[model samples]
Target: MRQATLDAMDEVKRSLDGIEAARARLASRPSSLGGRGLDGVFTRYLDHGSKQLTWLRGTLGSATALAGVASEVGDSGMELGILQMTGPRLQAAMFGTLLLATWVDFLQLADALLRDCPTCGSEKLFADLHRVQSRMTPTLADLASGDSERIEAAATAMPVLMGELTHEFDTIRREARSAMEVGGKVMVAAQVMELLALISTLNMSLPRPPPAASTTLGMGLVMSSGGVIAGSRLVVSAEWVEMMRRLVQAGVISLPAVSAAVRIHGGQVMMAQANQDLPEGVREALGDSPEVRGMKVTGKAGAGMAEAPRHHVMPKEHREWFERRGFKGDMDIDQFCVRLEQSHHEAIHGGANWKLGRTWPREWNQMIMQLLGKSGRETGRALTRNEILNIVAENMKLYDIPMKFTKGRRR
Candidate 1:
């Protein structure tokens, strides 16, 4: 098994070599936006790729060191406890390394496609890559309207590749979190059992009503021995070692050609699609099937649709409530909504609003987006007062609160 770990170290090194080769290939492309030009996207992708490669190399070194140490420890429980504690951190590092490698690979392919395309020539970027990448529809539309079949194919394939990557990262994140939780619980339980065993031993062997000095010394010894036993148990269990071994093996297999195994679910594909305002041509390229049409851009679902460009607090009841309470400012509306919910809860069951005013509003906004089934990039407009009130009304209505807000404020 140790030999296999040593072999994994070699495999990681080879992967690094492949990454370096890909980086070199990316660098060779003309980056200027002019004739036969290379754009800023290429430069940005290369720079990000370089940083990720550096991180991967550093993490690989750490993994190699850990493997070597484990080999020498050879079944020592105390050493095993140290390794067990270190296991999750090592797994996380490997995960990061592999994930970054995969991202770099995607960037490499994207760079190649853009550089090779005639219609979407490598134009110098005036803005950030994220700004361009986030708004992919315009680029796709350009490709679709032109005679550049190669570029069109690349543009269409990009979203599919992106969907696969999202699924892989999401899956790994969830599985790694679950593994860490289970490993932690196992360690804790082992320690607790060891403590119980020590207490039982003391109870059986110690004199009934022993001397105080002897009792104190014996108690100290019991605690010290219990700690040793607890530490040893983690390494001694075949289950734990096997888990770590499997995690290491998985890391070895995750980087190269993982997209083949990753199933791109509808949510990821829809998110990639909805984040952009796709042109009809590009939509046709993406099959323009019923599944595609079923998806909507942000804030355009069923009865939730708003024709007006803006929405605001039009209801006299809400305006009066706000004025009577003397709550002014944009944040004040958020506070009112939160407090209203808390008041009703307190009225019924009596509990304070733990997440009151100014408590991680950014996080609260993110949570709001998640609940609304929208991503940050897709949310192009800030909700007006009436819009906020409408959302609050949905929750409030669940608790039987009157939703008296007008749909749109009159200009």
Candidate 2:
């Protein structure tokens, strides 16, 4: 591995250690006067923090594995592929480290509030806080394996989880007012709102699988299985693709052999399809022709059917602003669209009240426009493709939008 990658890994590890120490110190704080109810809250907070640290450690392990593979690969092209694969894992580890540190600070704030005003730490409040902590625990314990599917699932669950936390905190704040003096109540409510902001940040920062990778994997499964298996059944995630490339580079597998096996498997699937009987719903869903099924699996509309609505990640309304900022050429703003399920599309654009400016899509577009305008004003030139992507990624992180950008002519 390159020294820079090694250095990054070391820094991440050190940061993790620092966070652990901070959490330990918080955990070791003297018990609150409010008895076991308050103590239980503190313990649960520490336990949840520990779980997050474990997940971060697992992410670092994955980055290390990719780095080892990158070091062994002689081809520059392969090296670049490894770098791309490893970059996000490291970024996620670092991001998680920062998030955990902030979480600890929030916990400390809560601890202090309870210590000064034990009456504020009502049994009901403690119960609500505990519920939020339980909800925040990692869904998968074996995240150290760096399983992309599990990680994506966990990330997908964040928005709902954080939203719940926000609601609970609001309730906690409202209830706290009745149990404390006016000054103490104001402090508690302010702290709770700050925590709510942190929850929003957490929702946006969690890593999600890119749409292109999922689409490619879905299509690959359909083609490989000769339409016998549903495309949605076996997605070849980006992590799996990277693992395969690493195996090939290490000489444990050959491309020709893999190709041959896929072809053979496809033939077998075709034979099975001929003799097997499918359920009525399955048969209806698959239709009578393999070709038509393949088209539908890949999100393509047949002659008489319409595809799902296409939502432009880079809003079409502000096309000219993006065009002026180097969003044309290979990275055309027009090509950045994703076909979303109808309800999802509606939700993004503000559902039935889309005309209002408060919806996610509207807010996201406004943020992007401001970014572009700022860049243009500062540099007096177009932003590079990578620069534009960085801006988009940051905005997505800020707004809790899933990071799904597709670049190509719409299907």
Candidate 3:
């Protein structure tokens, strides 16, 4: 009877494993590859972890074969018992992979929201690419030439570039914390954060040495798209804006980093989004909005807020699909984003320049004051960091980019 009990427990464990794997896949839906663009790319990466779990399940199947062989040897399935422990380890591996992929994907998706029109707050996605290119081109020279004078000149100018880089990393870190890791493991957050700091540390390396693998903590975040930040309140946060404005005088605080951080801060702007359940049929009339499903009628359909004709995006697959239909070579996503920023003129609210290219230094905390001063004179409202995030989310809604909730939210 005891032996039978153990066997039953093993079967239950196997069944439970299967359920967990399935749940993860359903929640993550991790691939938008069929037509969703980057959103799909990220989802597919998450799905890959699910596929790994399937392999683990298959590995466990071999346990039965070992059990039969042990039975033949009169060993009471001793080999199978040995194989049992492997399942739990594989389970851990699957969980780790899922967590990693989810965080990375969350960062990417959030950035998409920021870079896109509407969410960029009157800016384009690649607004800062030129700045990066300028720094990278010469810095690449520093990395190659090793001349002290040229390197020193590069170093003096680095804070501007470093600011952007720092802001980008901080944004990735901050958004990764809120959206991706919410209700998830704190240790996981710590690890990812350490990885980010490691990247930041990499920025100051040229004067002494190129960033070593150890310093990066193995993240290899590099010049890849992973370095981009999502739009966020941090960009326009009163604290940061005031700080950045003072940077011109201070001479060094990382304007680029500040810009990147602002973008990251903007990514926090997520709302329940309008849906069919919301007042007015605007959601439905928008033709399957990406931001909402449908709308609900609040009053007689002539309410005060309703008069503005509140429209929301449902599922933008069809619209975006048509937009990208004739694309051939790799899309010039950077220039496309620049145009997006220019789309908004005097109507630019909240006093942010809204040009991705126009950014402040990160370490220069005084820019916040300048920004607020400018806001007081222009927009009549000085925003806190959180307000900036809300506006960013609003902008994302306008752009029609796909924003997904974390995997746990699927249920």
The C-alpha lDDT values of all candidates are 0.36, 0.49, 0.31
lDDT per residue, candidate 2, 143-179, as tens digits?
2334333343333233334334444444554455555
Sorted by TM-score (best first), the order is: 2, 1, 3
Model 1: how far residue 106 lies from native, Å: 3.5
* Least well predicted 10-residue stretch by lDDT in candidate 2: 267-276
Worst window of 10 by summed lDDT in candidate 3: 330-339
Residue 36 CA error for candidate 3 (Å)?
Answer: 6.7
Largest TM-score belongs to which candidate?
2
TM-score of each: 0.32, 0.39, 0.21
Best by lDDT: 2
Winner by lDDT between candidate 2 and candidate 1? 2
lDDT of 3 by residue, 1-411 (tens): 223323523643554465555446445444333323224334443344345445434433443433333243322222232223222322222222222233333334333333221212212223332333343444434422322223333333333344344455455446545543454555655665554444332222222213353232211111112322122111133332333334312222222222222322232111112221421211222223433332222232322322232112111222233134321111111101111122232122212443432243311112333443465467665444233323323444454322221011011
Q: Candidate 1: global Cα-lDDT? A: 0.36
Q: List the residue pairs that clash in candidate 1.
A: 30-38, 31-38, 32-38
Q: For candidate 1, what is the TM-score?
A: 0.32
Clashes in each model (backbone N, CA, C under 3 Å)?
Answer: 3, 0, 64
Native-vs-model 3 lDDT?
Answer: 0.31
